[model samples]
Structures are given as structure tokens and as C-alpha cells.
Target: MNICRPYLAKLCSTLSGGPVVSGCRWVSNGPRFPFHSVKDIKNWDLDSDHQILPPPSTIFAPSKGRRTRHDNFLDFKRIRVTAGGGGDGSIAFSHSAVQPFGPPCGGNGGRGGNVYIMACKDITSLNGILNNYTAANGTMGSSNNMHGANGEDMVIRVPVGTLVRQVQAPIYASSTAAELGDDEGGVEAVGQDETENADEDEIDVEEQNEIYAEQMMRLLEKHFKFKTNYRPREDRARWLMERLPPKPYVPPPVLLDLTVHGEKHLIARGGRGGQGNPHFVTHEIKGPAICERGEKKEPVWLEFELKSIADAGLVGLPNAGKSTLLAAISNAHPKIAPYPFTTLNPYIGTIDYSDFWTMTLADIPGLVEGAHLNYGLGHQFLKHVERTKVLVYVVDLAGKEPWRDFEILQAELEAYKTGLTARPTLVVANKADLPRARSNMEEFQTKVQYPIVPISAKERRNITHLTGALRSIVEKAGAQG
Candidate 1:
């Protein structure tokens, strides 16, 4: 009849080497029970070696004959651009019948091409622009003092809210070493000397020479390894890897903010064309056959990042019915599954209220604990919610701790940016059709001060009421803004 009696009997049975308990397992010759106590059996390790098993190969291994599809929703891109070089000036003399060798008639060189980036609403990502872009060179000047044609400018189109920044070119070490072949000849000459000395004192001189040669080789190898592999550490690859600021590092000031559509920013300017030889044919130096060369073009590296803009955003933890509610309320077809973090990217959907009013709702990827510190999807997609006027908090009523989920979500938003929690918020209790949902909802209401709207997104129950409530909140927020 005693509560402790059953547990004591089970423990005695396990110690006596009877049948193994359901929760605990046996390891060979290591310990009677691997776990520390009976309460810790739930977190027991069955593997004797205690090595963690990796994910299945079918899930992690790359498949043959399959190509990864290009992601069109990329928010950031780094590109290297080389502008065209200016054309060389022409040096020629006029050969006319009336006046042969007429005043230095050489034409001027053409200007190099310029690179420009413009923001447009039609584009949604930077995937359309290739990694490397080279502009066309200008046409060379001709005889008879004909002016050279100017190069056509290159215009790159990107999505609105794109920011462009110029980055410094990386410096690399020279591939040719100053003392490359010095050790080769010395080693060969030493070997020859050792062979000659071996005949004189076969045992003593041979062993000494071999040992000296081995020590010399080791010293040379270490010296060369340090010089070739370690020195001049700032290579192109390493420079690129460190281009972005690390976590907790404040971002550098933006060079250009392309928030407006059709806004253009000149990232790289073209070199100016040189003056023709005719310009130098002055009174001091008449008929001078000298023509200047065009200036050289400079290299440019640009970083582009896109931030999405929406009227409202749905924020919640993973598998909290955010995607389901979004799909039910709007025309957006975001991927929805029972697994966590199903939606990897932000999905914007338009919600129409009546014929005149409509609002855009962004369904961002789920946020976990430490999201403000850049954990689990991180602050990458969190910026997309900054411009939202109204915030929708989605919670699963059938979850183990529905109220705690709401608090964690709010804490993440506040930590990311202040005044985020002060925005007009709407609380949604999803999955209300579940059996335990009603009881959990009652507990959630007593703990939370905000009004909650209970709706079953899967069954499309109470959807109309939820829509009306969200529309009212959004409209008020817009008016206040």
C-alpha cells in the first residue's frame, strides 16, 4: 500500500539482475545502470560507446543527378565588378590633297563604362544579377580628328529597400618567391660532397654528412613553410570571409539606401577621356604629333542587401500554427507541416478587407529562445518585421505551455528593438478545436491581460471574427502612423 514500496521493489529487482526495467537498459561490464538515478532514465543513453550518431546518410548526403534549385528570395549578395578600360588615343596626320599633314588631326580616346545600380519594385531578390559583371569598353578614336564614341553605362536592377555599399579590394601575396630555387642547388651540391667524403672515411664521414644533410633539410622545410603558407595572411578569400561584421558588431554606415523605386546610385564612375593631339597644336608646339592616352578604370566591389516591407507580421514559435493561420486567412500558400521551422523565409500575403482597404501580412520564419541574440533563424529575417505597423502574436492552445510561448515571443521582440512590444498587438489562440484547447485557453486568459481570439485555422472556424479583429487593429495602427 506504500507509494515508495513499488519503487523500492523495482530497484531491488534491477540490482538482483532480474529482468531489466522498462526505462533502464544494461551495458556490458561498464556499470549496472548507465544513468545516475531512476529519475534520469528518461534521458538515458542506450549506446555503450557513448558516441553521438550522425543523421542518416539519406537525409544529409548529396544526391547524384540532382541539382539544387536557385533560391529567388536571397536578401544579400556580394559582387565583383570590373569597369572597361578607356580606349587609346589615335596619332595620325591629315593627308588631304589641299593641305597634306594638316595640323595634328589625331582624335581623343573614349571614356570607360560606368556602373550604376537602380532599385525597382519589379525585382524581389538579388538572384537575377550574376556574381561578376564587366562593362563594355569604349570605342577608339579615328583619324581626321573624329571624336571617339563614349562607352555605354551598365545599369543593375535590384529590389526596393536594397542597400549598396562599396568595399575595399583585398591584397594578396606574390606567388613568385625570391628564394625559390636557392635550396635545390645547395642540397644537390651537399649530396655530391657527401658522396666524395664517403670514399675517404666510409663509416664516419657518411653518417656525419647524412645527419647534417637531414638537419639542413628540416630547417629549410620549416623556413619555407612559414614564409609560403603563413606570411601575408590577408588573401582574397580571407578578406571576403571577413567582409561582413561579426555577431554583436555594429553595422557600418550604409552608402546608399535604395528605398524608393527607380532610384539610381552610381557605384563606379568611368574614367575621363584624354584630349586629342589637335588640342596640343598651339603656337608653342604646332604640328606636334603627340596624343594623350585615356585614364585607367578602377575596380569596384559592391554589397547589396534587401529588406522586405509589410503592413503587419505574424510572429510565433516554430510549429505554433503561424503558417497555417496565414494560409487560412490569406491567399499565400506557404509550406505547412507538423515539423518545426517549416517556413525558412518570410512570405508576404495581401489580406483584403471590404473593397477599398487591404493589408499585407508577412509570415516570418519561427523564432526560438535567444532569437534576439541571433539564434535559430536569427535577426536576418527579424528586420523584415521592423516596418510592420501591427504585430500578430500566434500561440498554439494545445501546446504544453501556451502562455509561456507568448511571453518568450514578446521578450525576443523587445530585446531585438525597443518599442516593438508597444505596437498595436493582436493575440491569436490557434488550434482551438483540440480537446484540451478550451481548458488551456481559460488558463491563458487568466495569465495574459491582452484580449485573445480563439480560432481553429485548420477547420476554418471563427475565421471571420478573427479577420475583423485584425482589420480593426491594422486600420487603427495605420491611422495613427
Candidate 2:
């Protein structure tokens, strides 16, 4: 038997009531022929397969804890986006050797880049999306009345069934108010000496952090909600050049969405270029030198959610042979185990027919009793089947009350959506090879209202008949849709 070094020392200490540290050296050298007490263990002869004095190892070691790993399949993401800013207008005079003092020749500023969102059919999730996006800024204007080049536009490609919406931004580490808003999960203490020595103008740390957060919010709304191409005129002075977020900037709500493949939507537009000083060169103002500055853009928040698209969906309770049936019918190699909750993510597989026609079937994670109330990631599992044309309920015929499972499944779907139960569906009675399955099916037939098809997914029996039935149901459902 293999034993650890720590275990030997503890055992020796408990046996002879001596210092365990001294006996630790007993395990350092080979175990030769013994002629004395426990101290003679170091002198014992060692061999390749020593029975009593083998090599020390950790095979029987003790540990404080164990860590369980979970695979991640990202389907939702929150991002912060910012559009590009406009270029500044230059002020230069056309000078020459003969005519030292010439007319104004400054160029106008260029417009900033824009942000676009597109739906693509290839992608299935938002795992590759970044948490932040910022468009390029426009170049500055120069002499010879040449306008600055516009910034490059960016396109964000998402899954075809993605839903996007603008929302409140999270607390950033760089913000001064992060101390109050961040989830630090710790208690704070204030010393009397420090508070008494501080000035009255120095606000309390909490109050200061709150004020900083409010100021940061106001600043973002003032800069990010810049929809206009050019800056608006100020009320105080009509003649002077003004900037965006006019004196009293009021924050407005913003959001958007795109669903169809190749569908595009503009999240933010670039700023407009400033006018040159020559534009003001009139009869009254002979030589104007004033120019406007380029407008700046700020960051905003957006959330992206993805839903799986398929022609048919398989639904059942945990360990109801859904994954097995999918693997037998299609080429999908999903995780299969004797325990419950083996399949954590939704998998889609394609089935091919003799005539080269193909069909897609999605294997969704198992649903629990309280699936409609969001138990055990129920909401996520249920949403993946919403886009399917047909639903296939796989029931475990080996169970004592198999018919009750069908009723529970129907109730969950009905609770999730008003008219979901009315959709076209098929009942699959799996595990027909098991003993008592036939008798159970007979009892199940009396309770259930729909027709049940008995089959053994492990043995692949009745799979052909099942596929033929699914083909007609899918065709009809697709035509109606």
C-alpha cells in the first residue's frame, strides 16, 4: 500500500509519544535490514518493489479542499461604445514673396467615423464580442483650404438571432466614484484623528465618491448623446462659436436592435467638421481669424443577447435520453453519461436524407420542474427552443410515471408563453429495451392524450420511423410559419 510522508510521521508520533520531526529523517534514506527500533527504518534494504519501505508519494495525501471546474459558453455580453470626433479647423494666410500679406486660406475640419451593427448567419454566440469599442477620430485640417480626412467606420457583426439594447453603464475603476459603487465586499472604518484634522471643504469620503459618480454620469450624457452633426448655438451669446451639450444638457434615453441576416443599424454617428475662417470673410469683416473647434464623442453602454436558431428542438427532463436520441438520429456527438445534467450547452446537428435534403435539430439542456420560474438556468434553456419550427418531447418510458412527465413538460411550455402549447409537437417514448417498459407504456397510454412512439435510442431501433414522422411534422410547421 502506498503511504504519504506526513501520514507515516503522524502514525509514528502517536505510537511512541516522541518528537515527529526527529522521525522525519527515518523516511529520507533506504530501508535496510532492521535490528533496532523505529529509528532503524532508515537502514533497511531498499528494492524496486519493497513491501514495507517503499518510496514516499502523494497518492494518499490529504488536502484542505477541491476545486470544481465548469465550462463557459458565452451567449450574452455588455459593451461600451464611443463614436469618433471631428477635426479642428486651421487658420493660415496665403503668403508669397511678391504679396507678403494674402487672403485667408485655412481649410475646414473633417467629419468623424460612424458605428454600424450587422447580423450574420454563421455565428452562434457572442463569445467573441469585446467589452468596449471606440471608432477612429478625424484628422486635423491644414492650409490650402483642404478638408481633413474622415475617420474609418466600424461594423459590429453579431449572430442572426441576437438582440441588442442600450442600458446603464457599470462602475469603472478609473471613475472617482468607484469606491462607493464598486462591490468590494468589505467593511470600512474611519479614524477620529484623520477626520478632525481635515478641513470642512474636504467632504466625507462616501459623500465625495457619490458626488464624483453623479458628475461622471452627467459628463457621459453630455458627450455621448451627441446626435447632431454640428455644434448648436448657445443662448448666452449668438455671435460666438459654441460647442455641443449646450449650457443645460438634459440626459435622454437611447437604444436599438437588429435581428435579420445582413440587417444593419447605426449605433452612433461621427461629428461634423468645423467651418473655415474664410466663410466669414464678408464686406464688413475683411480679415476674419476666428475658427471653431472639433466636437468630441463619449462612451455609451449596450447589451447583446443571442438565441439559437433551428428547424426542430428536443426537450425533456434531466437524463431523459435527449442527447442520446440526437446522437443516434444525427451526427452530433454530445456528452453522454449515467448521471443527470451531463449536457450543459445547447448543440445543433444536421440530418441528411437520401434526396440530399437536410434538416437541423437542436439538443437543449434539460428543464426542471420550475423551469418557467428560472430554476437551474431554466430561462436560458427554454429560450433556445423558441425559434424552432417543431418541438419533440422525449419521455423516459422506463420511469414509473412517464405520462406525468409529458404533462409537466406541457405545463412548463404553457406557463412560459400563452400559445406555446398549441405548437406542433411529437412524443418520443424512449428506453423501450428496459424491463417493465412495455407495461409502463401501457399505463402511460391510458393517461396521455397524444400518440406515443416507443423506441430504444441506445439500440437505434425505430429511429427510421421516428425520422419519417418528424419530416412530415417539420414540413407542415415550416409551411405554416
Among all candidates shown, the one with the greatest lDDT:
2
lDDT of 2 by residue, 80-148 (tens): 888888877766678999978888777888888888889988776687788888888888778878888
**Superposed Cα deviation of residue 240, candidate 2 (Å):** 1.5
Which segments of candidate 2 are over 4 A away from where they belong? Answer: 1-70, 171-238, 241-257
Error of 2 at 58 (Å): 14
**Compared with the true structure, what per-residue lDDT tens digits does model 1 show for residues 365-473?**
8999999999986798688778778889999999998999999999999999998999999999999999999889889999888879999999999999998998888
Instruction: Give me the overall lDDT of model 2.
Output: 0.73
TM-scores, all candidates, are 0.66, 0.69
The worst-scoring run of ten residues by lDDT in candidate 2 lies at 182-191
Q: Give all candidate RMSDs, comma-separated.
A: 20.8, 12.9
